[model samples]
Target: MQTIQTDVAIIGAGSAGLPAYRAAKAAGVSALLIEGGPHGTTCARVGCMPSKLLIAAAEAAHAAAHTAPFGVHVDGVIRIDGREVMQRVKSERDRLVGFVIDSVNSIPSGDKLSGYARFIDNGLLEVGGHTLVRARSIVIATGSSPVIPPQYRALGDRAIVNDDVFEWSDLPRKIAVVGAGVIGIELGQALAHLGVDVTVIGARGRVGPLTDPVIKAYAEQTFRKSFRFEARATVESVVREGDEVHIGFRNEAGALIHDTFDYVLVTAGRKPNFDRLALENTSLVLDDQGVPVYDPLTLQAGKHPVFIAGDANGVLPLLHEAADEGRAAGANAARFPHVTPLIRRAPISVLFSDPGIAMVGARHGDLKPGTFATGEVSFEDQGRSRVMLKNTGLMHVYVDRQSRQFLGAEWIGPDAEHIAHLLAWALQMKLTVDTMLEMPFYHPVVEEGLRTALRNAVAALQAAELQAA
Candidate 1:
């Protein structure tokens, strides 16, 4: 029973914990990181990286399929070896894991231990066997786990989650995805392109409902063509019968339908992973859903010197937001005054589906009447967009009509993720529309779309003024 003392003990060596480890060490604080699993977080392992690989393979297959129509025909000789593709995916995943390990190992005074850790008392954690660690402060960055509905949990090898999708050596023949959120839609489309009969079921109006409606419409349009997009539909149940998985769902029309598939993937949502942490002994506040409650500004739990960040805090579950929260908590825990700025700069959320969706600053409902105005330009009109063959999709800009400051922007089409950062930076800097519209951008680029969207906003302001006068 060796007892070790440290200045800080950080739990979970994912995105948030990794950054917190480095920052704490830089601030001259000795920290210990405890992880139950691997080094990299969800984004590196299960979430962003693997999903994007699936999407890239899907896009390549789509291009190969369309090559015949563009005068380059391979004449009936094309095949995708699922096993080989999966091997490549694993290679990429391993490379990212190596990168994370290198970064974490670079922290001078940070230590990582592998085992499920539990809170013994205030600022005390028990890892592995009798190794007790006591610190002045504790940071919980345990992150999240995939959501599996009760009805589908019994199907062992037939039903899967996004986390297990990468482990399959072969793609499913017919698959049913049980959520229309970011993960489900992205993976569903990718599988559909890989020759899988993919059907998506969701009790929502559209895919990626949290995104701007305009962006949602674009995703719905693009994805519906390849996969069965069943919106406002509820999945009744899924049962494994023989070698197939049987799925039942009720559509918006209240009609019960049944289908059989080789696999069924559930991506409803993710909740915090705190079951084994033994938080009951400590004063960490937990919500009804078992998620830790922490002050968003300080990332500190209400009762103890312990802090929670990332998905554990449940403030904004995105990876970037979690990293920002972790950095702030680590810096402040080392006696530096922490500031949680009023996220006036809208953090852009991007869904990298076939036609990517990007939204910055404020959603449509976040703006106030008379304070803000919106202007949009269709992707059909942009020369660069036309060349890319994306004649659909929309780009929307929100502006403070009175102050002429750009509030935010959202776009769904090519280069959306890269284009979104410009608007986010502008909103963060409180830049006026006049300032944005004056900046010069290169021609025949998606960036020019930003300038065009801002120009349209300026035109709308002028029209409003003329009518008022």
Candidate 2:
């Protein structure tokens, strides 16, 4: 067997792994990066880029069809060509994927290895069948894989996941989407707008990762206008029937729902790819969920030289979070003998469903009721929303009642993603509610809605103080 040595060894070449490799290099550490699959990052290949491409196409189609309300009628019918749409999505997805692949390729050939890496022992990794790597410290960023339920496996090709959905040359006429989380909602709504009959099933009564009740309710209301939602639903079984797939589920009322569709797309959730890593060879002890115990701030796995980051940690699965974790883990691994604490960014998440849904910083449930006050503004009458004819949801901001500090925010409204980022930055800087209100909000813009919400929060706090006095 071939033997190699390095200061740091990074497993997986996805979003997190690449950043870790770069950071380790920047830290002047000798690093070896390994991957068993394609070099392109997950976000560029399957998760974010391709998904957004489909959403963009769907948005264009929806815009053209709905322009009649704006007194702008198309001279000809606006028809969706599934083949052309998929082609365009694939063409652009490949370009982005190629860019990531090129970046990975730019690494020195001697420092890059292509194979499945398994831990044979602490500080040692066996690659593929022939090579062994010994490193002082290692970073695990193997990423995650889609969770395919056992019941759906028997249905064969009819059961699709996000990894398979983007590759299809033609979309199914009807699809039953399991798990109305971020992936499910975004793809489901986009497919529905593109003329695919879609039914989204959520195990809970919520869609997306919405924790705020106000935003969840408004998001569900708006989403219902685009497609069918079977919340509090569970898939009992799935069977292939000739050309179609028949799915059996129990609805919220416990009523049996049997439907036949062209395909069943599973977006239930994702689990970290730890099985192949042979982590048992290390001193790390995995918890009940098979995730290694580690410090969230340092990303260290126990007191050992091993570190876990990105989706592999199973903490925050968003792309930006993964990137940040990768950088921290890489730097820490490079500086192995001495550890430095890193402050994580405030949590920010967004679901790209029309009238986008977003949450930033602390969730509503995370805040103490008496300590915090909420401010809200509905987009139903917002000036910008009315002008754009995209008014549909609401924004809720949470603030500390006594300190007037902005705690967090959740919004289901037009351009909530952009507004969420602004809130995230403010929270990161520890900005106060009063300070945010003082920020300029251009007239007839979505940001004005945020200003209104912050103002309302201030007013609510004043009311509470007056009652106490």
Candidate 3:
């Protein structure tokens, strides 16, 4: 058996782990990066990058097919080549992954370790079967994996996850997408636009991460026109047929629906990769979900010299959050007893469905009633959206009734992704509705829609104040 020692050891060389290793090294500590899987981060490999590539292709196809409203007409049918689309997605995805691989390759060979790491005890780790590692501090950034329910697992090759989609030689004829979360909605819509028979089945009334009822309802309505969507599905059974996956569920009309698809794409959500890390051997306390109890600011696991970051924390699964958490966790691990807390960025989430959905800061469910004011706008008559012929939109902005400060927003609109960032910045700066209203709004722009929502919030707040007085 080989023995290796380091000041800080980072398990999993994905997005979070890579940043952690870098931050520790930047802090002038001996850092070692260990990985049991491939080098490319989730974003590069099967996540944001590849998914966006597919969406881009879908957008192109959709635009070509729907240009008649803009007085533009295609001479013939716009054909989407499934094999070509998958080829480009995989090719560009590989390029992005290659960049990440280059970054990992830059690390000195001595500072890198190969193999899965398990905690032998606090401050001690056994990696693979050949090496024993001893470190003063450990950073767990083990990313996450797709959770396949046992019923779906029995479908074998007939059932696939989001990662499996990127590997397709060609798109399937028909696919049943389970879970209408971010991944499911984005991929389901994209696949539908690409001429695939896609059915999006979601439990509960969830549509992406939307909590605002109006926005959620508006989003659900908009997507139903594009694909078969069953929000709050009554599931019967998910079993395998001869060469296909059979899905049985009750539709919105309470009609029993039996369908067979080339694959059952389960987007049930991802489980953080800490379950196999032997966390029970450590002194850190585990939550009901078996995740380490850690400080959000410092990322310290209990009082031990261990830190948790990325999807392993199961707090925010976004790439940007993972990177930020990784840097914070690594620095804390490198500094050990002198760990410092970091002020995190305001929360932001966006789903890349046509007429995208965005959520920022506090959710509607998180806000207490009467404590906040809600403002809304619809893009059906918005100038730029009308010009672009993408008038399907609904937006809701919220502000603290007492403080008049911007609280958060949930919206579905044309270019909602861009709007969400603006709202996130406002939330972080703690800007008031009046102050936001004072900001510049160029005439005939999508951002003008945001200003209208902010104004509505101010009026609503005033009305509430008047009612109280």
lDDT of each: 0.78, 0.90, 0.92
Question: Best candidate, lDDT-wise?
Answer: 3
Q: How well is each residue in 212-282 modelled by candidate 1, as lDDT tens digits? A: 67656666777789899887898787779987998888998999999999888988888788888887887
- Predicted model with the maximum TM-score: 3
TM-score for candidate 2: 0.98
Q: Kindly list the per-residue Cα lDDT of model 3 for residues 1-469, writing each as its tens digit.
A: 8999999999999889998999999999999999998989999999999999999999999989998887888997788899999999999999999999999999999999999899999988999988999999999999999999898888999889999999999988999999999999999999999999999999888999999988999899999998999998877998787888878999777889999899999999999898679988988899898998988889898899999899888889999999999999999999989999977899999999998999999999999998999999999998999888889999999999889999999999999989898999999999999999888889889999999898888889889989999
Cα lDDT tens digits for candidate 2, 381-460: 99989999998888899999878889898888899889988999999999999888778888779888898898899899
- Candidate 3 TM-score, C-alpha based: 0.98
- Root mean square deviation (Cα) for candidate 1: 2.4
Q: Candidate 1 at 33: error in angstroms?
A: 1.3
Off-target runs (Cα >4 Å) in candidate 3 are none
Stretches of candidate 1 above 4 Å error? 105-110, 209-211, 336-346, 466-469
Off by over 4 Å in 2: none
lDDT of 2: 0.90
What is the lDDT, from 0 to 100, of the residue 367 in candidate 2? 82
Q: After superposition, how far is residue 70 of candidate 2 from its true place, in Å?
A: 0.9
Question: Is 1 or 3 the stronger prediction by lDDT?
Answer: 3
